[model samples]
Target: MTVPAAPFTPAPMPERVTIYEVGPRDGLQNESAVVPVAVKAEMITRLLDAGLPVIEATSFVHPKWVPQLADAAELMGLLVDRIGDAARRMPVLVPNEKGLDRALDLGLEHVAVFGSATETFAQKNLNRSYDEQFAMFEPTVRRARDAGMDVRGYLSMCFGDPWEGAVPVEQVVRAGVRLLEMGAGQLSLGDTIGVATAGHVQAMVAAFAEAGVGVDRLAMHFHDTYGQALANTHAALQVGVTTFDASAGGLGGCPYAKSATGNLATEDLVWMLRGLGVETGVDLDAVVDTTVFMADALGKSPASAVARALAGA
Candidate 1:
């Protein structure tokens, strides 16, 4: 076979980007069967070895709500013992003050809280109204900040909501600004149903910039239900957003939003970034191998295009 060469020019993007791995928490939560805690620990270990800087270890949400991660405490204990102080780089999601208390007891230094931009999702996910959700997060963020923990605020349904059709950019910005004002060090905007296109992403980020939210404090979390996650990511990169939320093997979806699908695959993102001459500090081969291992554990093939192609090869 003759090798065909395709010449390309790279787009202007950040020199180095941070991949916030969310497979262990967000990915596993939607699993129908509960994954063994040991398997979860090994997965995180493998991802860390693959050079993912910040991995979401688990969620402190009630077991009744997310039973998949019911072993949050035990998993964190094992991870801390195995990785030592590197556990500081692993952030856990906290739903409320109770969740924050659980994380604090673990000596965890990093945490995140999930918020919704739409009223219906807020009621379904958090059981609070749009404006009322802030009250729920206020104390948790305040106490976390007091403990010197870096709190990340996740604003879901930034582009579209299932209950409500398209979300206004102004609505997302207003909700996101409140999270930052509540002491969240970073704000991750979520395209919850994966209905966002590249233009919508650019406009959303631009709106945030107009509201005085710098790119440094923003992260993009895209879902590939419509096969638009990577394209949306490229749009984000064009605007200088340096952090992205991805799941190993593309193994995450929103449990609350039934229409939501798997997250942007870390391997796919790494492949694109490598091709673009962007630095992400990720080992592509290691990530593919890890995804294969996890796929065996789950009895499902990886959803990542890169992982599927590399594994078959």
Candidate 2:
């Protein structure tokens, strides 16, 4: 008697996924060479053309910290008209009250504030203790929300940190809860150092769920340094996280973490999501074309597999 093998069943996933494109902000922030405002505007326009519903346009951080994004105000001015589009959003990073003020002055309606779960990263990045960092975020979040702006919070090093070996899942959940309570409409869990494994991702998401933070209020941001980003994203998807952050052409890395590489590439995420029959409303071919154009401007080839394959084909 010949035994028939069972059919392989794909894991259940969300019917539609929302990709938060962070290439213009996070991606360009790490570049050693500064990109022109015109080029940055073009990238944003092309991303919108590719149908990305949410794009992080720029950061209001101090130039001393990230000179690559020094033209943040200028960039915002260039996109002032597009900011009025109701179908899409352009969220800018506001580090504190000062950053928030700059964003508000530009009439920006959406903003993101960032914090870290690990003490070392908080100290290194913000030059403050974890508690102090949250204190800073409180007023920023309050003011931003009071101004009627949609606020998103980013909790970095949620799974692992370079200084701290492995982060406890509870620590990340606590940070996320605090951020959500502080008035963040959405929270993004970041693997700042690219040390997250699929198991770590699952455990972290489960921990958040246990804390009463639903998957609807959360997003995933992974780095490809260990080549585990896609695997980790799969773990997140299985847990019902529909929003994932990606950088077009895999453009950025953490300057604070030297070993950290580019983010999970937008093209790669779209490729996986499309194969899973998940809808992202992103045109993969158009995204690849944008990346190809960006790579030429940056004088390098794209870091995404899909972009490379498409370019070759």
Candidate 3:
């Protein structure tokens, strides 16, 4: 027998939310310009001063792949010196056991392991099969967990895969579940190719939930390629996921997805969420100032309309 559906209802305002600032990592990963370690450290200080809790400081991928972040060790050193015991966290990305060892030597309190939702992205980004890639980082995750560190899981291309087109829901769920079981405190679902729609977002979130994954353990990372990031985010939020990542000025893009573009503007997300009464603990005006600083660093205007308006240029 078919169950009758209740009338549609508006989503209740979220009680609390986590905003992980990814400006230093995702925002700068694709930039052609090589940002100095000092500059990156300063930007991070500015972000923490604005009260963002968890800021992704940098990635430790091979310089061949992301020459922009070659200063990962230096960046980590600077962070430890500047960020004493505080509510803020600056987790660095580790591509393998080597990267993990390097970060552990620096005594980091948090670290992240990156995995992709598709074989194509896994092979393309890390030059390994999905299984092989996960195997490579498994030890890294274990070490971080044993050290009492907060570990985050990132599943790239969660919505769509450039080489494979739409990724099956099973593919993403398998990847997400693996990471969660591997000791990831939060699983950040990345729209790596930036081709996801609201409908797609709804399906993926539902599948993960139905699979018995906790919504609090999930986060959404969207790209505005088709200008659908905010819409996709709204869809995920409607399903009870509370955490979302944003670049201050929408400062990122897919190196793999041709039509994929920048992140949904942090300023815009903050405005909308705050208006909805969500407590993000971020200062909108400070975020605008930092966006302007980031714009100056990028040598272009910020992608955020809200940031631009606040600057009053």
Candidate 3 Cα outliers beyond 4 Å, as residue runs: 1-10, 86-88
Name the weakest run of 10 consecutive residues (lDDT summed) in model 2. Answer: 1-10
Clashing pairs in 3: none
Report the error of model 1 at residue 81, Å.
1.1
- List the candidates' TM-scores in order: 0.97, 0.95, 0.93
Weakest ten-residue segment in model 3 by summed lDDT: 1-10
Residue lDDT tens for model 2, 1-313: 1111432329888889899999999999888889898899989989998999899998999999999999998888878755455312489999999999998887788999989998999998998899999999999999999999999999998878888878888888988899999999999999988989998888888888889999999999999998999999988999999999999999898888787789999999988887777889999888999999899888888878888888872
lDDT for each residue of candidate 1 in 210-289, tens digit (9 for 90 to 100): 99999999999999999999999999999999999999999989888999999999999988887777789999989999
lDDT, candidates in the order shown: 0.92, 0.89, 0.82
lDDT for model 2, please.
0.89
Error of 2 at 111 (Å): 0.6
Summarize candidate 3's per-residue lDDT along 67-172 as a digit string, tens digits.
8889988887777777664422578888888888877777777889889988878897888998998898788899888988889999998888778888899889
Model 3, position 311, has a per-residue lDDT of 86
Give per-model CA RMSD: 2.0, 4.5, 6.2
> Which model, 1 or 3, shows the larger lDDT?
1
